[model samples]
Target: MYKNILAAVDGSSHGDAVVEAVASLAKLTGATVQVIHVRPSQVIGGAIASTVVPVEEREESQRVVDAAVARLRGDGVTADGEVDEGLREELAAILIERSEALGSDLIAVGPGHYSGISGLLHPSVSRGVAKISHVSVLLVRSES
Candidate 1:
């Protein structure tokens, strides 16, 4: 029942699964997909310093988005991509905002990879998005 979908990727193996899941769903529902990659910004020097994202980092993020869009298009799914900059902790919010801006009905993201103390220290992006998203969320688990 989805008319538009937003797929978030991190260039990981799980990211591939996310693309695949989105592609299948988009094709099934005739939904257009918008793929996005958020490059984690880092503050230089100190907290007061400006947030900086290296050129290489920005290029890599664009590459991730481009690849996902290409794969979806190759599968005969209409798709486009964009790259955004944000902190790791704010990924969920960024994705949700973009999804709402684009009027997306579904958001597909990869499964969380952290566990134990690490999991507690760093919350999962997918879980965060699912928790607060007004629309449907699909957590694509990697087959590996």
Candidate 2:
């Protein structure tokens, strides 16, 4: 019953399943879907080491998002994608902001690395967003 859905992703192997799950849900509900990738900001920048993601990362991100978009399109679903970079918490906030700006009704994210009780304590994107967002958030289990 959602009209607007935002799905955040990283190019992890788990992303394939997450995209599939999000696309399936969107298709079923006839909801518009937006795929997102947040490039991690450089926590420490120096000649020695930097947490900043390389520019090549965006190319890889595009590959992932393009594949996901094609899959959704193949299913006759409307989809779009965006790539941004910031801290993880900021990434989550960006997703929420975009969802609202785009008039999204729901946000979808995959389960965290933990399982069961630990997972709840960890509270992945879905859990965190649900608590923080003005819109509904869905937790999708990755088949990986």
Candidate 3:
């Protein structure tokens, strides 16, 4: 019953599962997908720094979004790409904001399967998004 889906991708290994989930959902519901990649912004002096992003970072972000959009479209689903900066906020907050702004009915996110000390240091974005999101959230976890 979803008309529009917002898929949050980071070009990680788990990202593929998120895309697959979104593509299948879109195909079943005849919905369009909007793939987004949010780059974490640097903080300076307790505030978000508005510094110019390096060319390499921008290109990588674009590449992630482009690949996601291509995959969704290749599945015969209408799809588009977006790149955003999470300034002084968590990635979850940005995704929620974009979903509301885009009027998306659902949000698909991957946990990325962080493990060991790294997982403890870095909290799960999908968990945060699912907790605070106004719209429905689909947590796509990697099987491996």
Candidate 4:
């Protein structure tokens, strides 16, 4: 049974699915939910590009978290949210850190891209989160 749940949202294609899944779980277990969206770090360009994310982008990340929290609340779940950013760490690391900070019992993640050459370039979110997190992780696969 989960007490506090941390749902990671990125406004991706599976964003809604993730919220819906987490809401169901939270409702069933009578647990509260905290949604978070990590602002993507700056991508280094050719040789040595700036590693800082734009201010607007960071604000947008917070908006994403707010929206997810709103959706969860609309589903009659007690939910709040926060925005996180990483200077050098990936999203998975950020999510795990936030979960620990919030004392979340479960970290819920949506489906990850696992096909084609692009998938090979980055590690899947679920795997990365599970590998680094101390608590349980729920990977809600996208409804095909």
lDDT string, candidate 3, 1-144, tens digits: 999999999888788889999999999999999999987664445346445333238888899999999988889999999998865247788899899999999999987466899577566788888888888999888776
Model 3, residue 57: C-alpha shift (Å): 0.6
TM-score per candidate: 0.89, 0.78, 0.85, 0.85
Error of 2 at 70 (Å): 1.0
lDDT of 4 by residue, 1-144 (tens): 998999988787577778989999989999999998776664555666545654347668877888899889999999998877764347788888889989999999986765899587656777889998999998877766
lDDT of 3 at 4: 92
RMSD of each: 2.3, 4.3, 3.1, 2.5
Query: Best-fitting candidate, measured by TM-score?
Result: 1
Q: State residue 27's C-alpha deviation in candidate 4, in Å.
A: 1.2
Candidate 1 steric clashes = 0
Preferred candidate (lDDT higher): 2 or 4: 4
Tens digits of per-residue lDDT for model 2 on 1-144? 898888877766566677888777877889888888766553558888777554347788777778877887788889988876666446567778888899998887765666789565433655567778998887776666
lDDT tens per residue, model 1, 1-144: 999999999898899999999988888999999999888764457656665654346778888999999999999999999998886678899999999999999999998887899688666899999999999999998987
TM-score quality measure for candidate 3: 0.85
Rank by lDDT, highest first: 1, 3, 4, 2
Error of 3 at 96 (Å): 0.3
* RMSD (Cα, Å) of model 1: 2.3
Badly placed stretches (over 4 Å) of model 3 are 44-56, 87-89
- Model 4 pairs whose backbones collide: none
Deviation (Å) of 9 in candidate 1: 0.6
Report every candidate's CA lDDT: 0.89, 0.74, 0.84, 0.82
